[model samples]
Target: MRVKDFIWLSGLLTVISLPLSAAENDWPVYGGDNLHQRHSKLTQINKSNVTGLIEAWEFDTGVNDTFQATPVVQDGVMYVSLPFNDVIALDAATGKQLWRYQHDLDKDYPICCGSANRGVAVSNGMVFTGTIDARLIALDAKTGKKRWDHRVIGENTGISEDASKLEDTELGSVSGTSGAGINMAPMIYQDTVIIGITGVGYGLHLDAVDSDSPLGTVVGIAGKYGRRGFMAGYDIHTGEQKWQFDTIKSENWEGNFVTKTADGVELPRNITNEKAALQENADAWRYGGASAWSTPVIDPYTGILHFGTGNPSPQMEGSSRPGDNLYSSSLLALDASSGDYRWHYQQVPHDLWGYDVASPPVLFDITIRGQPVPAIGQAGKTGWFYVHDRRNGNFLYKSEAFVPQKNMFSLPSAEGTIIYPGVMGGANWSPVSVDARRRLVFIPGIHWPVEYKLHQQAASEGKDAVRYSSMSPINTPEKHGLLTAIDLDSGKIVWQVKTENPLIGGVLSTASGLVFTGEGSGELMAFDADSGEKRWSGKTDAGVNAPPITYRIDGKQYIAVAVGGNRLFGFKTGQKIKVWRLP
Candidate 1:
């Protein structure tokens, strides 16, 4: 064979061998594998016997806070993270604690928002977790003792300078991302542990003024507040920072100030004013706030990692920062070995709305325009599931709207503009699961509408000009959750199921022709993957706001999830990791 042909053959073999060597028994990675399919090959708990599945075991992590962890199972041990960054390893078959690692946060630490931890990553006998205090720690898998700890970000003041006196101002809750932390499950690839930061886009969140007023606003202050968010790779063995990729583009951060998106969607932007402001705020990228809130997926064969970026700094306020904030609110591909950018597809340029590409990207092969292509898909806060060419970041097609859409790109007005799928998005940081066999992707969505109204800072004794701003919220008649199944070939919704509350965690699919997800009301339901028919469900004590994972140990298939409620959403909270199996 020719030299080029030999090299091509070797690359193809490496990609194909991954699935064969992965073995369907363990869920070793965050999305179950490099593909982020979140689909398992275990069929012992098939749809036919799904109704017979019952709670097999339950373990309390000893903390009653927002538990959003998806447990990682390997061998017979299940490694999970709890509130406050604590971790525990339990026996997969029986809920017996093997070891526990307790993390103590600094008393003066400033947490930007809730204390929910997404999950943990286990690799080469070490367990990794990112803390709410902005630190990455490694612990021995067997004994749960601290191996090493590294401070990922600087001390977060949790409040900005200008908003310091507004702490007691009944106007709204202003949060600072000064020392923002991590909420995503650290990803392990090759010899590195990859993770990102959160809370960089600091803003004010106001609860509905009162019970009579359910439409509160989120105010975005324009001046510098948080630092530029980044994703970094670390040496898995020694806890050393290897490389880092800042989400916000510093150089050429200001683009052409285009009036529309690359996909041809018109934007509500004042181009002339923005262009003039660019020269004065040229250094805005230094404190740009596009956080890395979701875990990244790596394409093992090509060594490319795919992940989403958060909203830009001073989210909702575009007065200070100008130009298309290059990397925020976009899908990015990076070299796995070196944290170098490969390509980026910005969903919303100069994002004034908090429309973060928060959901993790899922990779799968799809037949686009009658041609099979490697693709990456992300369900956006904009209420669309976008598919793109994995190699070059080209927009292929987008799925139909899964949630309601009204006043989509409308700027916040003094009268409170109503918008669907507001700040929370049709899909939030919740992960999307893909079933390559059926060419269908499952999305857990929220249908909340927001009342976006701008509030102006009055010209006081020293200030001459009054600044105008608006807060975001859903101004809907009813709030609900949507579990949607979208067909890749048609970009159409196969079927959708609505629930009582907005879905927060994520979805899980199995080879047994089933898809499982949790609801804020504490019900874990299984549905027919193809038809979206509900098969069975069991109610937990608290909200099941986390992803579910299925793994086999001793030839028995088991499903597990964290059952603590979400604080931001006001769900009932607990401290339980519940596992179910067929009786």
Candidate 2:
């Protein structure tokens, strides 16, 4: 925290706290009403009329870079975060730029392969966004004027004035560490805005061959190099700190050292070796790398918030940090007001592979054995859609793998080992859409494989002599995407449509029996929500690599998405937001 933030907090403590509120019909929340469903009830552009849907308007932000924001539509205006955490307000029907806020970034701001901001949150007459420099800013909804700015994370890692001169710069990706940044859109609940930090975990990234190829090799270095990650809530009115929940468990983080997952999936581990190493390294949890990157879903009735956690520290190699890393790679249930932990379900205990619970959790009601039960669903890097009891974090069942799964839990070898649904995941940070009325969930999937190989070497002549091992990737590979519809009751796939490139963005399903999503190939597509048939597509100048949103203004329905492509995933980059309607 900075001195200015402390002064702001001190002033906020003198004011009274009031509850926040949200708009029902507009796309105000990140996942549309805090359920994280990404589904809309508008039916103007139905299945029968979707074929005639055409471009209504387009706005280019003039920056040819990664744009992954989901526009927040309220009243008649659309608020979106452009590349580099910039913001713009446009007329929903005409795409006329009403206001634009140029984010002034620090010259030495810590960043990585690309600048990607998911979106923004609009609540209580204000628009809020988290920046790439790990700061949160609030703006007046009507005027786009800055209200208050606060540093969300500590500034120990990259605050030095002369940090650029270091070869392996502190908080730089080349040094096996990254600075805290807000890649997730803030979730504004009643009177409190919730947000999390990412890039706390260390992984090597290689250059992709082209725009259509899969991501380059992900190298996981084995050592202590990352800081702990957290999610916190702030006062919507005064910008005061409310409460925070740390992702990494500090005390008793090495829980039970369970050899298999709670559901009895066998994990490849040497328990004896892990138990022996635990005594010497009991404090490793202080630097665990369980970053909370995705936005959270809240049950408005009970105020119970549900979200997923990222991979454990020293990601791929787990020799130094022993025991089951509690809370990492799991689904968490917490009290929305107090930030108290209620329950957790770990997906991979002692995770040696980079399998994270990367997608946002979706809340819906499901019939269990003949009765209605509240359920939470999440798509994993492990290639399955896991359904659980929303209140208790109990696993109900897992759907059939959406993407192909091979050598899922295999150990990395001296000779390379092929692993399907690699670090990017069967669904990576992409929000799934659910039509509760139809009992169907729409998932965007990827089929990118990684060749995990281990490299062992002798100590070098100059540096510290620590016997370390690294996991590296093999070669450049081709990939594809899948749009899958699954039956919520049977946990089975109803239909799947394959695309040319891996689907790295998200899906949106509407009451009109239509599904809309984007691709790395620069195509914004619409499909028959029931049969998985392509109904319409509009080619763009760049990849449509962001979630599409739908809202109604003046009796007209419009679908909008950020067409600015993704750079890390080998997608052509640009800065364009395109909207469509029946023309």
Candidate 3:
């Protein structure tokens, strides 16, 4: 292959918006670009002046719960989303709230995950977000007023009004269940606006927000007209649907429940949109796991859509759906144009720990062996880090090991040992930073256990009885969290900075010869990309799940982070975005 073509095919240079230092390099979308690199090109805030950073300003985001919002900045204006699904436009330099678009979320949200709004995607002079309340909203980039609202999920997505209004009746309960809602920021690929639904049969059933009947199809709505998740494309100016993809089957679903164990293969309690329909073979989609819950990474150049899946339903039980659930807890590669599964890698076969591969996959090319190849490195919620070939989902580097015989799966020869990073992900929802300079992937990871206790009406009615329906907070069993630098080529840990709390928030590395990391304990820190020594850090009001960003306004280098305990990540306070400028 030609060197240039080989590098492109190797997954290097995903054609993301080349950050141009100023407004040109704005961290505008979730993952920074379609590839979700969470990387930046600014070097002004490098290791040299990093320690001199002093608080410039702070904005009151007014949120409660662990907020993990990646702010989108455009034209000197910053757009941030929060746990309550509130979108606010702020002055980029001053941190002043310009306009706030509240999602109208109630104190009680019916979903397993706590209140978290990943963030927003902007284009054509409008800010877009998939709301916790199940609506896809577009706002004026300048004023933050709602331009149009398309009920992408919930009742607006064709849900019954009564059903849509159901409260998160199961929070703090043992069942630990939540209903349908949009949490991941809506993905914008070129002109088509894509969104996915998480939470699950939650309090409702699977397919609760499976909106639009045929359920589980990647709907592409138009940017112009207001089309909702219906029809197809919306006019760039009209917001109308131009086209649509529906999950309709020619026949009813059919599949016998795994009444008897075979080779002790766990019976699949759930199925994919395809299997769900096949198992029913009747006319309805099954009620188990099988939902599109993660934001997809797009190969803007190749137009391939890569997304991860959630656990097959029944929450914690895997015996329900056995035999390597086709796509659940899997990484799927599809033709962005046709939505066809080109290839897939099941991170967890029939996941029982509820280890959903819902985290965003970071894409970049690694100089493997002697050839630079296109590959992906992913950190899942369960804490597993996987480096695979993006072109075909092949393992490029294997650092984290499999569970071996820990998970009771009888193998002819141990197959591919399930060495997942764990549900909290060796790298979780908190993103990682990719340094092109050193070709290293900087990931903050959680090393904790999520001991699941089978919920059986829990004898009577107490906390234990309703725990499954709750979001488990962080408890790091004393093992210091790690900020691991992995040699992408070898999947080898170059250097690991062990901190007190789990290395929780996202990461950003700069060309200025420095790397930035955050913690769930309100600690924003800096480290030498080449060394593991901590050069600086500071305590704020809450944990830092929100990644840090750097930019230059008037030749002065600046750093910033959103301080709010991720109610979901174990933090309970903090409501401001703190900025620091080099003195």
Candidate 4:
């Protein structure tokens, strides 16, 4: 019974649990609340009228490719989740549409990065979503139909057995050989629902040859590919299964092999060939690959649940997945009802530079020393903005390097290296926004610097001779985008700005001082949440990447987003959704 007496009796059953909240004008869920705090208490549209806004409607969803969701809304409808998980309800004031459900994509499973989905979760009257082939479905929030589907992984679960001779090469045509699915965005918490599991740290991406343009080389390859990566809980009526957790730790997952970084940084390990290859990778947590990407930040006064975890499998080639991958690039914390394990902070233990805590964790409270605490911010892809201690994941400070870190943890080189926030991040799966009365925190970074390299391929004819690692973006530092705002009690950098295009997508903050974001060049912008100033922008035909939300109906105050673009950074897709108001 002692694991520090069950974490001090789970912090006294999380300080007498029962709060739940979320309705301050409704964006409903997925960063708007459950402490995701995408902030927006609705103050009409500030920064002096947000340039008089305009265009209060625009619904398309005709199925564009990487849109990346983030629409939610409630009582006034608006559900929105496309790029193939399909399910739209819209009408949050005239963007009409009412009911659509669709979904169906099994196409023999295997999905990774481009089937998008990121947005759903409305309570009891249903509307859940989490698909791209790992299933989960719910729908029926006033006629979108289908109530209950749940198949979160298990058809060929993790494929590999030479997955039909590696599906005929080029790493199975750029990773479609199965990375398992469910691109996050499913939260509920009372009768359960929660979600997770994403391309299980897969790898081998390679895209930009002008197929719209952005992510050109990812690679990874050093065998056993990927598998374990969980976070479950279902049964918001009958999808059944409850409580799952498992982001690789079937037994010490090699923890304590720490060569630094619980803040002290260092890590370029070898720890003597990883303790002489830890008994031949001791079952490598059965293909352990962490991938829960983002969408979890519960803490309703402490029932815990925070999220983040990605990169570990063969990703960036960490010697057959050796040690310190415990909860892969960690930030976990659970017990939202029963998934247990209460704390973890690990931002990049043995991560080999994919550095993924893929952004999404933002509770808030802060004060410290003068004592108020309960913290948990998190926008790192190794470019900082950490914060922690939401109960006991501890660390407590780190902000001020929104995007630009140069050789960070180093390692992969057969003559390449470079590194600045590589692996497409400095907040990838983007989602960060919390003004909690100006304690600030608004990040949306990604300066894109990669190179890395390491390759060696040979043995063809019948396959079997590889060892890889690749990452690309390093043409000489031109990529851009950052937006920061820090301050969380002086972890300082209270104003950052600089975006021409590398920002992924997500950030909203408001009470009306303002902070909205979007771009791959279709600009949605608006700033000055406290002097970052670029007050308003708006134009969009595509590439708003995804994430921007706000609500309120009869009394106006709109501003939604999800203009399709972002086919893994090439941007410019399009199926619209738009919204906006004031005028």
Candidate 5:
């Protein structure tokens, strides 16, 4: 059956747009609206005229690092955060610099990923950002001057004594070990700015040897090397923290120890061993790792905030942190006002495969079993698009696998077990876009097979023996990208398109029926939102590995994206923000 047959959209679009506050012509929030739909209502640049788009202007940030920020525009001014947490305001129409605030970094700090700030939040004449050194700062939107700054990671905040001691030992000398920091953009609700920390899921991440290739290997060292992850709310004007929610709960961190996923897919887990180790590791939550990797989408009417979490500590090795690892590798909902827990759905129970709910959640309304249901959808690294009822966290259905899947939950072996949709994900940190009118969700996905291998190093010459596991992309099956559109009502794939390289950026959909996304190959392409037809393509000097946003200034609509190549994925680095409009 056709997608439109299953999805009745005549009256549903009006209900979905009631609670969103973003203007029809302005890109106000990071995901285009509070729903995080990434869908614009403007149709000035529709599919028929998309091919006539020409470069309106281009601005250089002067810093060449991994640029992954989605530019936020309001009142003809654009606020964007660059690499190293530098925030800049630009004239939206002409791409002229208005004011720039340079963030000074500490000489030494901990960073799990490369230097990249996703974007900034603007509210009540102020711009807010979370720094790489774990600091949250607010700036004057007009003058670009600092208003207030708050240290997010306080002394012994997320740290444990045993984990700190491990950092001082010889084990800390291992390459690719990371520390705490924040890379996601801040989300502003009514009077509070919400942000989260990342890299707490400690693992050894070695980059590819070749500059033009994918990542080399991710080694999971078996020890307590990471701290707990959290999301907090701060006062907009004073930068005073209002409330904080730690991802891992201390007392009941050991969950039900389910041997399968919430969807009844049997996971390759040693449940008996996990239950046996539960009491011994009762205090494991102190160093538990469940990093918050993406900005959350809030339901204004219900006052509920929904977000996703990363992998557990000791990443690929699950022996150290046993049980279901409550809240990690799951989709969580909390009260927006109080930060109180609402409900959670663990996608991967006892996760040892590095399958994080890394992508941001998109909220919409869907028809399930002929009844209208308010729903939330998230693209998972496990290669499926999961849909659930937003009110109570009930599993509605999962879309067909967008990428190939083989031995999905297999354990790593000394001889190496190959798994598709591996660590890099069926979908990574890229945010998905939703078309509420059509009941379709667009996702940017990666298809790379990884070889999971276990290793043991013998004790020698004052060094203790260690066991570690590595996940490296294998050469077989060739890596590529998959841009898919799934029908929300039927949980079926409507259209799929393949690209030459793996996709790491986010997607944008417009009311004019055009879907826009960038590629690591330095091309910005537009597709027909319903049929997946190629509409247009443009080239840039660097890889367009960032989410695209659209806005209207005076009378014309413009599409903008950052053109900084991702360093870890071997894309060519750049420092340009390219804007285009119909000529």
Candidate 6:
């Protein structure tokens, strides 16, 4: 098919496949939309049909780990991602592999975090995703042939000054890795694909650099071509650079900007470039806090793009960059066209602890406080759920429950003073589901009190700071975790199921009004989306780290998940993706 014709047909199919209010037959993109709600309005597989649902077929991408991907469906094509950073597009109806694409990995698996990819994006005839090695590639939707690829991280792009300086005839020297290649899928909007990055070098225990850790980075790309990060964009049909937005220097930072290293090296400012969208908002590029880690959602009506900024680097400590780190770990509402900050809400101000607001924010209209309002919710690593009015980021009657934390981010919380609902949070990458009709945000929340310590990060000479990062206690006195159902509007607890570990996998909501999640003991559970009562449960090999996705082929509903041994939770390399039918 011609490019123009393909796009036209694809768009029409997208609209038609949308099951009016909700459809059971189609599962597309991560979280089911730019909104990432992960909810299906289709109720055919309800608490009843769900029992009769059978697994018709299963295709293993043979990924070594990270089943975090939610398959993207387009015109009966199912695109799924797996651990080891690979993507496969399959025939949605028969599970027949249509095409498989793999990125040549450099194999520097950052041990602290697993080398697993979240998933990919499909829009305008392209399949897009990032690599653990940091390349953002765009592939042909039908052929899986690499159309183009961009290196976002490795040594230096624009963000960090590298150990080796490149005297760019004009710009002089640029540092950091070649650029931290992408591990997550780029957010695909109409013509632009927005992406974020991760670096493993910010903090270290000196257990000696393990076999895994590599540098981290974030990127943005175009839909058609992988023009590269910074302000890279191209025509949706032709891989041509249309614009760029590069970071500005420190002197240009609008607000107080401070970046600290583990060894404590003070870096220079940036120069504005037309490639990135930050030239106009150059200061935004400089200021600290809340670096974006999760894919963003767009307000289809208002053109406001919502993304969660990651925790300030140097994971644990936050003594260096103070004040409400403008955008770090905050929900940044920006004008989609210009990348202008609309409004901001800092979940953890001057975040000393490693509280990255990296979870995808779910955008949906909800009735809150007895009034229906458009809302956006961010699930924090600190185990707190902050639901806000998407229009202005106003707090929607705190969803926090009394919990415990010890001197987190340097704030002395009196045990249960400001207890968060769950430490891993109301939602993590395991996407949350909301049934608009039911008016509830179905979340499999984590319950635990995360403790912190001052880990000193030093490179060679005096490059160090009082940075803060948090880790689950190796051996502690207190331990807790829980799964919760929340009313998006009133912020009331609909129901909560207690878990044995620090909140295992994610939750899946179906139009059939069922909420599915796994436990530490490796069980896939289904419950009434409205009441949170268990209807059925199935066991897996190990705890599920990834969430479950449901799709229908030949009119049969099959739920899929990744079961693996996560090092943090003491699960070995037991990684396997599993699909389930009602039986």
Report the C-alpha lDDT of model 4 over 399-430, residue by residue, as the tens digit. Answer: 77887788888887878888888777788888
CA lDDT of every candidate:
0.83, 0.79, 0.59, 0.78, 0.85, 0.55
**Whole-model lDDT, model 2:** 0.79
> For every model in order, what is the number of clashing pairs?
12, 2, 88, 0, 0, 76
lDDT of 2 by residue, 200-251 (tens): 6555443223211234445555555566778889999877789999988989
What tens-digit string does per-residue lDDT give for candidate 3 at 186-272?
Answer: 666667777666654222222333222111111111011111111122333445444443221122212223322221336334444
lDDT of 6 by residue, 430-509 (tens): 55666665667766655454433222333434443222222333323344456677776667777876656555456678
What's the TM-score of every candidate structure? Answer: 0.94, 0.91, 0.77, 0.34, 0.94, 0.75
Model 2 Cα RMSD, 1 decimal: 7.8
* Tens digit per residue, CA lDDT, model 1, 11-95: 4323432443454898887888768888887889988999999889999888998889889988888999989899999999999
Q: Name the regions of candidate 6 deviating beyond 4 angstroms.
A: 1-24, 49-54, 107-113, 157-179, 206-235, 238-289, 368-371, 402-427, 454-472, 475-480, 572-575
- Could you arrange the candidates by lDDT from highest to lowest? 5, 1, 2, 4, 3, 6
Number of the top candidate by lDDT? 5
Query: Which candidate, 2 or 6, would have the higher lDDT against the true structure?
Result: 2
Clashes of 3: 88
TM-score of 5: 0.94
Q: Model 5, residue 18: what's the lDDT?
A: 44
Enumerate residue pairs that collide in model 2. 20-190, 20-191
